[model samples]
Target: MRLLILGTGGMANQHAKHFAAIDGVTLVGGVDVDPKRVEAFNTAHNIPNAFPSLDAALAWGEFDAIANVTPDAIHHPTSMAAIAAGKHVFCEKPLATDYAKAMEMTEAAEKAGVVNMVNLTYRNVAQLQRARQIVQSGEIGKVKHVEASYLQSWLVSKAWGDWRTESQWLWRLSKKHGSNGTLGDIGIHILDFAVYGAGSDIDHVFCRLKTFDKAPGNKIGEYDLDANDSFAMTLELENGALGVVHATRWATGHFNELRLRVYGEKGGVEVQHRHDWSKLLVCSGEDAETGTWKEVAVEPVETNYQRFAKAVAQGKTMEPSFRHAANIQKVLDTAVVTEQDRHEHTV
Candidate 1:
């Protein structure tokens, strides 16, 4: 499979590295708005072609897939362009930042009969997969509640000023880009994991979001600071399971800590921290009586790009398809709506 990467950002670089490492898959080229970044990535990766825009890259028409790793705002347009060019797409998280655009992208891919995958990488973790298996196997019979949290300390430090001090941060902080910041960025991953693990759909959400130190004594350029730094929400799942989601960029001393706990009639499982070496702890009534918890050693799973490539080669549907991605967007949309309503009614 030939692949064209559509950005030179951090996530795009990560995808490029993983795709290049996969056998039988060729990283054809890359495109970025910044000429220097594009040229540098091409030179570093030994890629023969690098274009300044997606339009230029699409003109080449040699790629079988496009990795849309641009910012949240451009994911829709970039993926649509690639789909129009008859290429499968691997879009980054939050899909399109809203339900309608996300549904449109899903429909376009389905109509074109091409594969569409979203990079909700947390689901690929071996421990999380094992947890899902355990949950579905009646070991955790009839899940009742799930609590998930993803936290980062980046925005809690003085260095947060440096990031917001740039005009480039405007796209991420503004709603016109389709998201309200950390919720759309990291919250989507936790939401996807919640839906995937519990094997249920969220029916409604009640959210409380706060900007905390808005403006933060450090204003940069003329961009409006309208994004939330922290958000918490309660999810009512279709299966009568209650779930809570907490995401923040202002958690001091924490760096990418993603933790989940699920309670069921038979047992419960906990994923302590997903971003690094963490174990899946399972505790049943028997184990609780014994005052012990069963620890499952979790081996890290490989990149989803490899899985995507293999699926394409064998003509199989990648688990958590674009439709599944759309479902995740629906939950996120509900959370956003709840947050907005709360904001409007604030005293």
Candidate 2:
């Protein structure tokens, strides 16, 4: 598979490195609006071709697939172009800025008969994969309740650098800069993490989003710090399970962490992923009666990168598909609507 790194941002490096390491795949080209960034990306990754725009890259048209590491707003247009050119797509999360565009991309990719995938990076966690397996196998019976969260402290800590001064992070806190904030950012992640592990799609959602004041007048230069910094949602799965999903940038002390707890009639399952390590725990049979939770062994799962490459090679689409992502985006969009309309929204 000949792949194009569609954006030359920070995350693009991971895409390039992972795809290049695949035995049958090659990084044939790269695309970006910034000349210096794209050139630096190509030089760092040894990509043979670079283009100033997606149009130029498509005209060159040597690659078989695109690793769309573009910003949240750019995914729709670039992905549509790739699909029109009959190229497979491996897109980053949120699929698009909203559900409508994401659905359009999903439908176009499907109609084009091209393999499509979204990089819901949490899917790569072995514990998440095993938790899904356990739920599907009825080991946890029918999941009745779930609790999930994605927590980060970047706002309070300088771990990844100061968002107050850095345009990269500042734009994320501003709506005009094309950022959906924490809910739009990591919300996709924990939503995918929870719903995927529960083995069900969200049926309805109601949410409350909060924006905290940062700096005086909440103004950091040209960027208005109005985007949500924290959010909480009440959701119902298609299987009639009730759950709460939340994410926040104000979660101090923790750098980054995702945890999911699922409870059912017969048993319970829990998965925790912090930084690099993950673990899956289960309580069932007599252990449930005794109130004991034991760790279950789980093997590593194929990453979204590897899966996208394999799908391209095999002419098939896999989990975390474009459709699934669009559905996830529906939930995310619905949450935003609930905040706007002051009521629960359906997914």
Candidate 3:
């Protein structure tokens, strides 16, 4: 799998590292809006080529697939371009900031017969995979309710400037950049994992979004800090399961934490990110006194990149396909609308 990576940010570097590590994959080049960043990415990753734009890369780079690690707003355009050129795409999540645009990309990829996958990173966790298997095996009986959250303290005043200043995060907090703030950023992952674990799609949502910390004194240069810093939503799953999701960048103590708890008629499961990738707990049986939650050891599995490479080499459809991402997009879209409607009703 020869690949062109379409971003020069942190995630792009991770992609390059993993792709380079894969036995049958090659990181051909990278593209970025900034030539300097592109140069740095190429140099850092030992990639042979770097281009200032996708057009330039398409014209000169040798690759059969694109790693669309670009920002949320650019995901749609970059992916559509790659699909049009008959290249498979491994895109960062939310598919697109806009649901319709996401649908278009998925439809286009399907018509082009190109492999499409989203980076729902948590699904690659071995414990989460085990949770899915346990749930599907009916050991948990019927899934009844779920609670999921992704928390971060990165936006706290002390941590905000550790990497980049508050000004740098403004783009993520601005609508012009096509970020869904904390909701579309981390919330989508919870939604994807919740659905993956339950083997169901979300059918309805009632959402609320909050911007606790805004850029001081009305503006941070030209960009306004209007995007959500936190979001909470209630969901109804197609399989008749109820769930609540919360995501925040304002949590004071959390560095990066994602936790999910699913309860069923007979048992319950919990997958949490603590010291390790996943800490899983499960309890089964009808008697409360006899059933006690016990830690379940998670076995190792292939990394997401390895699975992607295998799918490419064998010409198999990747899990969490573009269509699956489209479903997530629908959930996000519904959350936005539900929040708006809730606000209007209150007003």
Task: Compare the candidates by lDDT and give the number of the best one.
Answer: 2
- C-alpha positional error of residue 270 in candidate 3 after TM-score superposition, expressed in Å: 0.6
Q: Over the stretch 1-347, how does candidate 3's per-residue lDDT look in tens digits?
A: 89889999978988999889988798888899888999998999999987889988887747888889987888999999899988888898879986799999999999998888888888778888898899989988899998888888877756446423455566777766566788878888888878887767888788999986554663566666777889988888888998888988878888788888888888898888743457888988754357778889977878767777787787766887889888788878878888887832110
For model 2, residues 218-240, the per-residue Cα lDDT tens digits are 99899999999999999999999
Q: lDDT for model 2, on a 0 to 1 scale? A: 0.92
Q: Residue 322 lDDT in model 2?
A: 96
Worst 10 residues of 3 by lDDT: 159-168
Total clashing residue pairs per candidate? Answer: 0, 0, 0
Better candidate number, 1 or 2, judged by lDDT: 2
* Per-residue accuracy of model 1 over 1-347 as CA lDDT, tens digit each: 99888998777778888989999989889899998998898888878888989998888788888888888778888899888888888888878878889999999988987888888888767778888888888887898999999888766564444455554545566555455677777878888778777777787788887776556552335555677778888887787888899998778877678888888987898886634567789998788567477899876676678778876777564866777888777777777777767632110
TM-score, candidate 3, is 0.93
The collision pairs in model 1 are none
Off by over 4 Å in 1: 158-171, 174-179, 216-218, 342-347
Model 2: worst 10 consecutive residues (lDDT sum)? 296-305
For each candidate in the order shown, give its overall lDDT on alpha carbons: 0.79, 0.92, 0.82
Q: Pairing residues by index, what is the TM-score of model 2?
A: 0.98
Better of 2 and 3 by TM-score: 2
